[model samples]
Target: MSLSALLFPSDAMAQQSGIKRIDLQRHDLSVFGYETVQARIDFEPGTAFGMHSHPGEEVIYVLEGLLECKFQ
Candidate 1:
């Protein structure tokens, strides 16, 4: 399946849920002695983020959406 298909089963679902994403920034972590990335995310009702991973670390804060997360 395509990446978007893997992440979102349906385009209608993605749109209905108001899934908006912005790649805030990216940088070479060598200067910080660790590899990491960060960004701001917005999710509307019915939106879901598929299972994924990071190389080093990750942190997330809920700006909204009842602050729920699902994993498999």
Candidate 2:
């Protein structure tokens, strides 16, 4: 599997009724040694994220299926 495929799989579906969410990253958040948080998002497919950038840093990763990102 390509890196993209490994990081992000196919489309995602919303939680069915009575089924609880069990995403580790969502349920168990990562602790960053910072007081003022800037940005943090956990996305399933169909979840939306706007374009982003920062001071010489452009970081992107997938916590779940195919976090389709576009910036311009």
Candidate 3:
């Protein structure tokens, strides 16, 4: 298993009860099982994710806010 960090807006957080979201299921994470993805997500001010991806070919999307994404 892997671990990640994140943040969310008060209103959004209130709805989720202070839970952040860093989704790894970005358009089939299974495609890249040889990669290490790390990043921070904050919604208080805004939402952002750092570099994320595995080896081989894959597709990704934030589905919400803009993603500062990079592949390695």
Candidate 4:
């Protein structure tokens, strides 16, 4: 598994909550029988991501604020 950090915000956040996203880098790699993708999703947030999911596996780290997540 790989871990990553992001500050992605919702569309409404950009206009209403003063959020922004800065994509620093993105790439895909395959090794043996595994595939991996690396990306950066930077944002300035004044709101929270309501509901979301990603393909395969995901790891996230937050720099500030609080995160409430529900998985089913």
Candidate 5:
């Protein structure tokens, strides 16, 4: 399964939680069986996501507001 499928919430969940995701770009790497995806996610005030895992490397950048994260 794709990383987005693993990490991104379903449409119903997103609508209920006031979360929006915009996929910016996707590309297949020159190396065999490798790919990269970039996306932007927006969350409403007081909204949060449950603990989740990604299938590959993940990076996050916050354009505004403070973000709290927990890792285990």
Candidate 6:
């Protein structure tokens, strides 16, 4: 799957849920079959994303507000 597909909600869902995603950069890694993706995601108050997982490592930095995360 594409990076956007893995990291973002569907367009219709995002519109309905007041979520916005801005892709900052995407680059292929030196290792074959690996890549890195950077993005800025904004969520309106009370908005929440569904459960999902990524293929590679993920790093998140929240600019402001409370963010709750769950992991298995």
Which model scores highest in lDDT? 6
Model 1 ranges with Cα > 4 A deviation: 1-17, 31-35, 70-72
TM-score of each: 0.53, 0.33, 0.25, 0.47, 0.69, 0.74
lDDT of 6 by residue, 24-48 (tens): 7778989898778676777778886
lDDT of 6 at 22: 71
Q: Comparing 2 and 6 by lDDT, which wins? A: 6
Q: Whose TM-score is higher: candidate 1's or candidate 5's?
A: 5
- Which residue runs of candidate 2 sit more than 4 Å off their true CA positions? 1-40
TM-score, prediction 5: 0.69
Q: Report the lDDT of model 6 for residue 24.
A: 76
Please state the error at residue 65 of candidate 6 in Å. Answer: 0.5
Per-residue lDDT of model 5, residues 1-72, tens digit only: 012322343455456656777777778878788677676677777877777665566666777786776877
TM-score of 2: 0.33
Structural RMSD, model 1: 8.6
* Candidate 4 local lDDT, 28-71, one digit each (tens): 54645434443343344444445655445655765555555577
Spell out the clash pairs found in candidate 5. none
Clashes of 5: 0
Clashing pairs in 6: none
Which candidate model has the greater TM-score, 3 or 4? 4
lDDT of each residue in 1-72, candidate 1, tens digit only: 011111222234344445654445556767566434445555655656666543454455655446555644
Candidate 3 structure quality by residue, lDDT tens digits, 4-31: 3232222343345223545433333444
Question: Between candidates 3 and 5, which one is better according to TM-score?
Answer: 5
Off by over 4 Å in 4: 1-18, 31-46
Prediction-by-prediction clash tally: 0, 1, 2, 0, 0, 0
lDDT of 2: 0.32
Residue 23 of model 4, lDDT score: 44
**C-alpha lDDT of residue 64 in model 1:** 43
Candidate 2 vs candidate 5, lDDT winner: 5
Which runs of model 6 end up more than 4 angstroms from their true locations? Answer: 1-16
